[model samples]
Target: MTTTGTSSSDTTATGAARPGGPGQLAGRTVSRVGFGAMQLERLRGDRRGALALLRRAVELGVDHVDTAHFYGNSFVNGLLREALRPEDGVLVVSKVGADPDPGGRIPLRPAQRPEELRASVEDNLKSLGVDQVPVVNLRRLDSGPGLRAEGDQAVDIDDQLAAMTAMRDEGMIGAIGLSSVTAEGLRRAIPAGIVCVQNAYSLVARDDETMVEMCAAEGIAWVPYFPLGGAFPGIPKVTEEPAVLAAAQSLGSTPSQVGLAWLLQHSPNTLLIPGTADPGHLEANIAVGAITLDEATVASLDAVPSRSADVRIG
Candidate 1:
């Protein structure tokens, strides 16, 4: 799994330029099998390990990497800057809105005012060592009883859009996107030229299927946050299902590979940003692109029970 000397020209069975080859991002194209840099923070381990993982991901042909100013006191972006050169074909997308607390707990906060938003974008530019980010998602206020009670105190969607539009016009961000959004939120943002949507989606959390379909129909890229359920770590439940297991057995691949393959086959608009702090795990996740499920296997996987109803909106 160590990618100390690997080049981008290494070919796979599909003969694609790279894993999950260039996908549309706000009309621009980037790799579909993107890397999520959340684990680059010193969340529960050494920061050096996280930095190495970022370098390893780039070496593995993951051209798209997602992060946020809120991740690890913004240290994760710095780590990415240290590992990746700006000229590499990397599309770094970051979100704004939440800030880390003293204890490292992240809580949803009101969107910054127009001037503050501009400053925040500038701060992200400095930390990530980039003049302009490929995509910037306006992390929305988390929906729940407390936020609901806050009511009018929350940043108005119109105001948020106004600020984002200004950023887009200024060329600070190449495209606009939304995270943790609802159908209504999307309806409001779509008119403002949203090109991407990020939400918690996996076999165990399918609540955003409607949004996924909408993005597909609109030709917007839908990047799922947790392709693997957060509740069950390390266990490949989605790929262990009877249908997937059979496919994996036939293909001689792991369950995780089958799961990711199924996801890619399910929707052309789908882009996965699976996160990992380990180089071996990152390589394994990227290699999932080699597994292709047959039509019958895909249909059987579609018939599997969905957790769409159990996902909590908060």
Candidate 2:
């Protein structure tokens, strides 16, 4: 399970002063460890608690935030608008191409039509109270229920990239990103240019490892959405697995901390945007940036078996 080319300098922690140690994201220098606004609206109906959490994260030197208009049905972005000032120095990365209904139901269908993309970006600007979003990822539609592997299916992202490229040309977006994509999809979209890729990846889920390598080689930031393995409830839990538990016990760290450290060591280009609603949980997650795993531990964790059929390492 030992990564081949990882070095000590590449494993810098993201503390309040360091903040990922001069890492660059989307051509913008930002913290390698960032915040995700997905669960902010789910904090037991505590809006102020959520706002306080955002401000606290920034105070801890988190300069990058992953969010979307559909997150909490645009509620999270509105909260961000209140928490962040235009000169807060935080890069708010939002997404388009998926429109949650007013009630915020499941199965967010794709809305990548050119007109729909324009409207979606406009909605994000209005909700976040920003003139221009730093980055906008075009999320691809899933072919089925759970995460589909790159080998399972392929999606054409040419049109989607073209639309986003137009927006970038118009100065509406700072950079372009892709989500839920396969290697083939990235290949199709790369000609138009991309700055980042946000995919579902974790210690247990190595499906997108090749994509991670590709991003590394191309100097594109690899932003993994579910680095902690919480996106799919039905999938096997990484923290509960025997290998992770043993490593946590041996290292005197929590399972969540061990999991995140694995991601930071997995690749230098790997940037984490782990999400949480509780302030305590947020602090705990930030501290994960400081945990360093030994090679033996990495091998042990890598040997952990995948219990879900969704394991797509191809």
Candidate 3:
């Protein structure tokens, strides 16, 4: 995979764009390198910085931008809308479900009543400042164990599909996606022609390996939300891995870049949405697209020891 684009103003802040991989979403060609908008809130009080990164993303040729109403109280979507022109050929993918309460807590369980799903879609459209979002993922609860525990019945896949189909028919969303889904869950949802699947996958995380392969075989885009791992404290950073460090040193690239390149090479259908608040880091993230790993290097990096499976996301 190779990306083609000149460095933007934020290039120095991070790095340059690498070659990009190929993927099609709703019949539109998209670069596998996507901007994750979770960092927009870090610049909330400093809107200028957030806007700059958003604009820089477009200028850098990032066609896909991921956000969610549940992120930063829906401020991230608004910032995205404010930063880019309406017809700039950017694909905005937002997730619904897990509406946080006033206390800023996402329920351990999901509540996707038909009416609730409808309202969530409407709110997402309004918050995103677009009549139709390129993709809307129905986020499932991060529960453990049994299928019933994951809120499978809370929002039936058929019901969700019906809602998404209605939105697509109404031109409110171009495609539908699913996040945090299990193999069984995805099997149930597959009939909907899910365009994408966002799950926690990285060099250290392979919980979604089967699902990722399934998406690849089906020509559906597989989006790894935490391609570099979660932002929370105590989580292992991809940059800290010995393999990533060595690769970065050999290529004169950053660890983040190496981590992302590893993911791009992991699967043709894989798309990464690594998020960063600093313009420099964002540019560096995009530049990872340029780094290529030789077969030996790819094997060595793939052999790096990962943390225990106990750390896996539910």
Candidate 4:
């Protein structure tokens, strides 16, 4: 937390050399299709296996990774530390607003207070073994498909931003990002120089369509979590859609790949951080950039019904 931000004049990275095509995140060029380390918690007991998967991602030209200190109680962060080399220019993005609750069935509890957010940043630095986090997302608990802040946890956005600004100015962090935020929240946070937004969006889940476009217009990255959707209640799975399945068959790709490709083509600023513990799935997720959907297929997928989801990426 003592390191200064990698202050720079280059507003974006020329990421043609990276995977999933290049896009900006935290003011750096990173592959639009990055890796999400949350799923590595399932490999907590298999350190060797986890390390191998992460290494394989780097080999595929992945240059962006999204993680959180509360993920497996910092278990995933530790794996990133061992598997990723800072010299490789991998931009690690971490989110705060929740802490691991090992004793709870859900294993996560909101820690949204301003002071707690600051502490979470330091915890992430220590766990990930980084001098300065390239990007630290302030995951607002104002609304959620997950735990909501209550009582003292319900702090003002200004107060939270104040803490984050102090850290950025002092060089503890490189830039700021937001997650699980609404249109109004993103507007209020604009002056802070937000570099990205992580929301629950996918081909089947288009509730944040406007927000995604806003980010694009503002030169902010739109990092969608649960890009392929999941089994959670209300969060529809993208692979099950009839149009997606048909496109996969015609293009000789998986339904999952079709869903991911659509998101990339949906918005130029959109970044995908699909997580998987399987090596094969990791390769497929990164290879999504090569899958192209013609206008006709894209239109059909876009025509598919959009539904509201109770759960977004936490």
Give the whole-model CA lDDT for all candidates, comma-separated.
Answer: 0.70, 0.75, 0.72, 0.84
lDDT of 1 at 166: 88
What is candidate 4's CA lDDT for residue 45? 82
The Cα error of candidate 4 at residue 166, in Å, is 0.7
Clashes of 3: 11
| By lDDT: ranked, best first | 4, 2, 3, 1
Question: RMSD in angstroms, candidate 2?
Answer: 6.3
Q: lDDT by residue for model 3 over 2-96, one digit each (tens)? A: 11222223221123332364456655567778789887777879998888888887777687788887677778878977887744566788887
Error of 3 at 131 (Å): 1.5
TM-score of each prediction: 0.83, 0.87, 0.85, 0.93
Candidate 2 stretches with Cα past 4 Å from truth are 1-15, 103-107, 142-155, 306-314
lDDT of 1 by residue, 243-287 (tens): 767777888887777777777777899888888777777888888
User: lDDT per residue, candidate 2, 89-197, as tens digits?
Assistant: 6778899876776543453545766678888999998998877778899877542124332432233467667778898898888789988777888877877778899
Q: For model 4, how does the per-residue alpha-carbon lDDT over 8-36 read when each residue is reduced to its tens digit? A: 32221322245556677766666778889
Candidate 2 colliding pairs: none
Report the backbone clash tally of model 2. Answer: 0
